[model samples]
Target: MNDHPHQSSSLTAQAGLPSELNQHNRRADDSAWIEVVQHMDSIYADLVHYQVELEEKNSALEDAQLFIQSVISSISDILIVCNINGEIQQVNHALEEIIGKTAEELLDKPISSLFCEQHLSLIAEFPEHIRSGSLIDCQIELISSEQKEIPMAINCCARFDHENRLSGMVVTGRPLGELRKAYSALHQAHEKLKTANLQLIQSEKMASLGRLVAGVAHELNNPISFLYANMHALKNYQQKFKTYIDAVHVNTSHDELQKLRSQLRIDAMMDDINPLVEGSVEGAERVSEIVQNLRKFTTPQEQKKQSFNLILVIKRAISWVLKAAKTSPEVIHNYPAELNIISNEGYVHQILINLIQNAIDAMDHRGQSKLVITVNKNDDSVQLHIHDNGPGIKQQNLVKIFDPFFTTRTVGSGTGLGLYISYGLATEQCQGDLTVSNHKDGGAEFILSLPLEAGK
Candidate 1:
């Protein structure tokens, strides 16, 4: 009787529903609330994790910025950054040191203002061309705040935004004064080395001359001895003729005068006198030739290159070599009558003489020894091949033949420098080449190819 509508419905629901059903519904509600609370807790934890990750990333970005600033400040090279309008936007401390201007003073200024007036055009064109993403390196002079000029080598590159549009240019420059000084030092060192090498070559030549002096002395002695002997016989003949003439003037008996003339053997002596005079003259001439050649080979002369007949040089070399040679190896010349080469004549003579002597020594007791020298001309070059008829070089020794102080002869018999010196003379002084190989038929063959033009 006391129930209102809402109270009546409440009372009915409570009475109609089972107690287990109510408890089961309550348990379901508790389970759903627990799930909602757990999901909220999980979302809170995830939010905290995300916040920490963002903080770490921000820290890393700040470190990277600091690192880049440090690099730009501490680097010695001048660093400059400009906007597309060619106005200075940023520059490193090195730029300030180079131009003697603060960053604030340089900002918004045209990049060309820092360059020399003549070099301004290069700066003007650089920005436009840098848009094509090309790096350009050029030498330019920059006018400092104090009006002093500083030469620099600058490497310029374009800076682009993520969309690939050019935003600005980054230029790095380095002073060239130190580089130039380094180059000068290197050049001086090179000159010194070249001079030292020439001295060494000269010393080697002296050593070669020393080895041949004994043979040269012997060569001179032969002519001198013959000339001296002929002079003695001429004096004796003169004395005998004077005695016969005096006997005739004294009005001696015909028999005594005849005896005096016969004692001198005047008729027979007259026949031999002409031959003795000729022999003496020839001996004197031979002595003169020997002295002249020795001087030509041993005298120190300037390294002046000139054009001359190679045939004459060969003949002179052959003559000198024949004087010192133990055996006369027949030389066969197959060159042009007047082949000309532009090089140092003395050095060429030395090389040929060494070659001829070596060829003679290789023949030993081998019968039918010959040194066949053939010179042929090609375009721009002349090749001289010296072929020897003797035992060819061993295959194993061929590779080491050109090395200095490498030889097959006995210690007392060779200095091991003849071929080495010849090779250096041809390749270094004359800009030519010397090579050796075994002859197909027999013996060793040396081929020397020289340029017809000096210093070719």
Candidate 2:
């Protein structure tokens, strides 16, 4: 022991311990080795289990990345992800198509590089709002490789990491020019559909109006017809009344003689005879005229174009409107003489009827009304300008007046389709132009430029 550099406490034990004590120390050392071996085994098992969990977590992360990349690839609209430092970390297939750059070329580039100098301000202005968790919709113009400018709608939102911290941005871009074109096309289609529906409703209303006008004209024809027939009878009765008056005049000197005569019979015969005969003839003529006009106005004939007298049709139409409004008041016309243009006579007549009657209705329940129809023959066309002294359509609504179902009047009073159908007829059937504008005389003026010669 003295030769050794140091001695363990057990090895340097004073010589007092017996052989039993020495054996006990050996037992203690053995117990320590057993404990150490068992503890090392437990630690090794824990380490192996931890390594398996690590591998599993790494595999899940890789799968998630793959899934995200697949989703971005399927989308046509541009998808971009940029880090918080504004470096573009990821871009999808559509981004290459939009920017004319490959993924390798765009990666690690500044996000602001996508926009030009003019549009970069919008990004700086709105990026803070986006980072604060607010979604934004904006427009940005991107410059392509060949210096082409493309307008796009950019929707932006903040992207966050697993720690709930903002780490990057996700922007979705869609081309605006194509979208705008599509929208315009859809809007036009909707407008056309609306027009068709209005035309149908107007057709139904016009049919009814034709029937009503026919009824009124028919009613007037009867009285006028009778009166015209009895004109000769009225003249005969007038002659007899004159004879009776002369007899009375000659006998005025003898009141007593007159009293002695058949006073009641002579008085009664003179009074009823003249009035009955004269009134019937006058009324019957008016009734006849009204009926004739009504028949011609509502002539329900299939279209067969032939050489027909135009002045006659206009006269028939004007008479129809006038006779229809006999109960209310009179509608005077400045109808021109002998306008002979070849058109579908029935349709032309109907057109004239509508224009004239519409004017009369404008003067509804008024004391006096005036509707002027002036026709001028051009080298190849006949121009008819119909004027009314009623409320005119406003300038803003002038163009829309031709739109179906767009009427300024109250419901059930006017169908907005009158002007529309009239326009269609003038252009389609007559091969003419029909237009309306506010006249300086505080009324609406409708001008119909009809072809002079028949359209074969």
lDDT of 2 at 106: 90
Query: Over 4 Å off in model 1, which ranges?
Result: 1-302
* Predictions in order: lDDT: 0.82, 0.72
lDDT of 1 by residue, 75-156 (tens): 9999989989989999999989998999999999999998999988788899778976678999998889999999998999
lDDT, residue 74, model 2: 86
Q: Per-candidate TM vs. native? A: 0.42, 0.40
- RMSD, candidate 2, Å: 22.6
Residue 287 of candidate 2: its Cα lDDT?
Answer: 56
User: Runs in model 2 with CA error above 4 Å?
Assistant: 1-17, 131-135, 195-456
Count the clashes in each prediction.
0, 16
Error of 2 at 137 (Å): 2.3
lDDT score at residue 24, model 1, on the 0-100 scale? 64
Model 2, 1-456: lDDT tens digits are 223222332573566577787777666666666777899999999999999999999999999999988999989999889887678899999989887999999999988788877977777755587667788798888788787888988998898899998887888899999789999999999999999989989998997786456445434443544444455555765666666577677765577546634543556656666766655654555555445655665684334566677778776666555644543344344556666667777557656766776677666655555566777777898878888777777779977877766766787666555566667668877888888887898777888888876574
